[model samples]
Target: MRDILVFLIVFGSIPYILRNPVVGALMWVWISVMSPHTQGWGFATTFPFAYIIAVCTLASLVFTRQPRNLPTAAPVLALLAFTVWMNVTFPFSLYPEYAFPQYTRVMKIMLMTFVVAMVIKSKEDVRRLVWVLVISLGFYGVKGGIFTLRSGGGQRVWGPGATFIGDNNALALALIMVIPLMYYLQQTSTNKWVRRGLTASILLSALAALGSYSRGGLLAIVAMCGFMWLKSRKKLMVGSVLAAVGPALLLFMPQEWASRMDTIDNYQADASAMGRINAWYMAWNLARDRIFGGGFEIYEPATFAAYAPVPNDVHAAHSIYFQVLGEHGFGGLALYLLVGITTWRTAAWIVKNAPKAPGMQWAVEMATMMQTSLMGFAVGGSFLSLTYFDVPYYLMCALVATRVLVQANLPPPAPTMTRPG
Candidate 1:
């Protein structure tokens, strides 16, 4: 019964965990887990997954058999507290409705960061969690891919009413960031069948990413692959040739894909793309004009009115840097960059030291993936507010925390003492 309960908690909740309130509740209690800020259609606009995670986090604190790992959690907690304080005291005004939702969004991210740090302690724990995420998302990807191919492939379907849903893009990014782990597992797994299965899963994920039709997602995959190539130049050159030729020979792609490629260049002439440029300029102007900001929600409508003749309001700058600049000015943007840089440096250190420990091979792989994901977001953020998604941000924090824990568990360097005769 206990095993059954655990299985149900982990597996049964995957589909609805991000959007449903009931499953989300289960997730918080070690019964389940999900990304709170996934872009999808569901029962709620923002999804109740974060609240569920918070609940489960509290439950873990109260009832888990293992003692709380405060050392691993301290940095995460401090960061969360600071973010909340900054949000509340930043002296920016926003529409009450918008501000309230934004507050919850920030809180959700903080909760995930805290829970992942506390919950994932060992190498095995990290592997298990990664597999769970991959399996759940892989199932969806396969299904979506089949449907897309059969129906002559158009916009991807999420749940009901999920128009413009970017969950597919989100899932793609998550899978790509785990590529190093997939490679490591393939190399290290004792079970041949398991290795084969993981390889198939990786391929399916890559295809699904292509099917999502998100230029940003494609850019991320390219950047990640480029990083891998840079890490191994000889292999990269051989692999690049094979990759370039393989797709042409194997697949007959739709014309829509060609159109999508054309759209990338459309930024030069397209009105919508031009509007983003205008928005950036307007954001800079607003930052200079206001002491703190013109107010959080005010920029979108105002900028649209000022720049676009059509009066199309924008809720966000669609770029994290511009959003920060518009909402919190130079000071807030500085702090945000500081947090991101600190997290990246910490993850890099783990990767640098990974070759020393046998068990750290997986950590090194995960760290590389994390770094790639960070770079993707850093670049993608120039054009989109990718930070609004919780999964990547929380995963980055988890990696940092995991690295710290791994280092702590390492035996102390031989103590040196000098005795005077």
Candidate 2:
């Protein structure tokens, strides 16, 4: 029955998608990110629903008469440049067979980002996309948080298989990134019950991240909240509440969790930490010697032997910074970093220049939460390999789109971030 239902939804949406490409794009996101079929105990688990939808959506785009509305923003330009660089490095890739498939996957994600940038033309479109995105990831956040509460954080919180947040560390980072989006939903919701539900979801998501026992996640939440307050117009109030809530959540976690995070202070003794450092060095050396880096599956013993001092101790590039550096080289890493930095500054500009009137409140709040989410991703991502994850890229699409929506009613671009007077 579950399989039938998912199949029906995917099949049913094709005509609508052909009629309205934007709807098709949204449906694609729902299937890709949330992966509802993965939850069911049926044939839907094996169904290639996203593939079918993508085919239909592309057909719709090509055959339909709808105008393609890609926005020109710094973030979007950086993304395009980065995508071009990835393509340029493909032939140079040491492991072309392995790298090409991963390249195709990233290409699909980039396609969706452009589809979103072109399709989402209004503030309401941005809001709806936010809702779908939040629901896609927040479902995991809410479930993980409840699991933590029920099990007393005894076990780890994992994500659906073959998905972005498949492991505990990735799950934690994904949940932390969703925290601000959850807050944005709560703030914009006028319904008391809806707001209350969002509040519970936020708490659960935080608990779930804690339950994942990811030390990087612990650091991320701190940096996320700090940025949340720092960027807010009402920083003092948010800071006070954060200060009170931080300790309470810490005290609620199990002793084992605390012990695990404590290894951050004694990283020299932690095997995992030392391995990550070794991998970082290996990536650095590979990029130094080979401009395009090793491409996909660069952690093999042969590649490591060429660049690593401790070749036998090779591990995957655990850090996003190193992940791109090793897979695509310094040029690729620079383009990747520019996308994030531009998105961050673009979000800042939106927040500052958003209209002062009541009708534009959504734009202000949207920009704030995006900045907070980027803060979580930027800081925590240093320790994780989610450089090509669609979540941040999707969120960046929304931010650039939001800037367009907001700027329609405003005079000009806001001044860049300024130091204290």
Candidate with top lDDT is 2
Query: lDDT by residue for model 1 over 1-421, one digit each (tens)?
Result: 4334444444566555444322332354222223322323343345444344566456545555654454333335446644764575345664555666566656655665565655556666565555554554555555555655565555553421231124555544554555545655665689999899877666655666666666666677778767765654367673875497437422634678657756776777766566666677666776776656544555557556764334563545767788777666666566667667767776777788766655666677677666766776676556665445554555554576567656865666788999999
Task: Give the candidate number with the greatest TM-score.
Answer: 2
Which residue pairs overlap in candidate 2's backbone?
A: none
What is candidate 1's TM-score against the reference? 0.76
Instruction: Report lDDT (CA) for all predictions.
Output: 0.57, 0.86
Candidate 2 residue-wise lDDT, 11-118, digit = tens: 998889988777888898888888999888988998889888888887787876767767889999999999888888888888788788888888898987788778
Provide the TM-score for each candidate, comma-separated.
0.76, 0.94
How displaced is residue 351 in candidate 1, in Å? 1.5
Which regions of candidate 1 deviate over 4 angstroms? 1-53, 63-65, 69-78, 89-91, 151-175, 178-181, 232-251, 294-299, 306-315, 409-421
Candidate 1 contains a number of clashing pairs equal to: 3
